[model samples]
Target: MDTIIKFRFLGDGDCPDWLLAEINTLSRMTSIKIKILGQTVVKYLTEGDLDEEKVRKITQDAKVELNDAKAMVAALELIFTSSARYAVSAADLSSELQQLGLPREHSAAIARLHTDHCPQITATLSSQSLRVSRLSSIEVLSCDNSSPFSTVSLKLKRLDGNVENSVINISKKDVHVLLTELRRAKSLMETL
Candidate 1:
């Protein structure tokens, strides 16, 4: 069954037409319904001299409907002008991932990581720190069973091992140098 999700956008003042268009485009792509609230709806209802209390009451009542519809809330900050932020309740994304048949623990771990660290293109675990290679690749490596300092070395060895590359023991201080050498090697190989 397709899950129907709703989203409410609260704007500081009269909402821009472009913003509404963008939301509509997203809704069309995702098959979700988006509702506008706060000053945007207020302006639509009363062109001038709107009563704040009345708007608040209407907003509260509409919010009840939104809650019943499993809608998430969001706000657009005028200060940012072009940026939009979603107000996602904690674990909401994890729950969605779980529903998609992902292991609960793994989903929770990924969600927590996303909350703590912004999206990475290409990321792999090396030692205790993460090695992010691209913003779009967000891959993770775990050292759950390896020795403390060998984790990153193990990763690098695995990556290059298929071509008969020799393994190297890595210290924490050697990570940068190792990455630089790896990059140079890759560049040289590309030219061959």
Candidate 2:
């Protein structure tokens, strides 16, 4: 009803066969169990990685195959993370999951977890993501030798609030190659 929410993780809203089968297992779970699993998913989302020990415990408790449990967790992680990225409302997420064949109870549980932890989830996702270090500055010093060389000093600003500095002695040909590459990268960035 609300703009037909599309989850790219679900591949055009058609749930994968593997996930559809896993949903059956999830649907059969008790509400408490589903809530616990949803909490684990939220933890995984906030932490930006899965806890293997937690997954093992979940498999043992759910009495499902290890791979199946993993599949379910992975699917739920992608769904909720994608939903968060899209800024989908909790009710919309629930409806989307139901449309994807998840039971109402399970969808509602997952949506509730998302509603409770959306800010944390989004924050962690933004902070923990891998991004290219930014080049703060570059300085080139030329040697007055028969065979000329350049001392290149680079300052890089990393995502974690660290500044890294490096110095390289480069031949003239290498400097030309580096400039060409930098020009190419600049062109590509501008095109975007």
Candidate 3:
């Protein structure tokens, strides 16, 4: 349950090639967006500096839509993390899990839970010592010392039934929360 904040710069595909390649590359990745005066914004990519005043002024001067710019930054951040194994899209996650020889049933369960029941997914993964969850609207996969480190959480939606899912290490606190939530959900389901 340790809160970790990570950021990444956007890439080149989403923005115009010219104008400013730095900005373009920096705007294409998935990142966390913070709102200022009802406008979503992000820290500067160059140095991880959070200067709202400067960012606002620059956006106003450049005529860039603040929300759009922030979206790009968020996307870039996601991509960067995905590339680094800290996070991944559903497809990438499945591939990684397959490589690790996880079972198809588990992968399917994970994908369904991740896409349709995120809280449950987080809880279930945490129960299995997998530190994978949705944070700030993006999926994050991580590991730490308290659990066995050779695990990965696969996206269930992408499984072909021929591959196995991966395992990951998660914290006890996270597992506890997940278990509690799962029990609550199960109780609710039983009532229904």
User: Each candidate: RMSD to true structure?
Assistant: 19.3, 7.3, 22.4
Q: What is the alpha-carbon lDDT for the whole of candidate 1?
A: 0.35
Writing each residue's lDDT as its tens digit, candidate 2 over 1-192 gives 555545544444645577667777777666667778778888877875667787778668868788877877877787777777778888887887787777788888888888899999878777666445544333343433346787666554544567767676778668778767766765554443
Order of candidate numbers by TM-score, starting with the best: 2, 3, 1
**lDDT per residue, candidate 3, 1-192, as tens digits?**
964322211221222233234334333322211123112222232234556665555555556577755553453334333333333344544343333333444334333322443333334334555433322111224334445432335332221234334454556556546547645754554443
Clashes of each: 7, 0, 25
**How big is the positional error of residue 55 in model 2, measured in Å on the Cα after superposition?**
3.6
**Top-lDDT structure, candidate number:** 2
lDDT of each candidate versus the true structure: 0.35, 0.71, 0.37
Q: Candidate 1: where are CA atoms >4 Å away?
A: 1-85, 118-192
By TM-score, the best candidate is 2
TM-score of each: 0.20, 0.63, 0.22
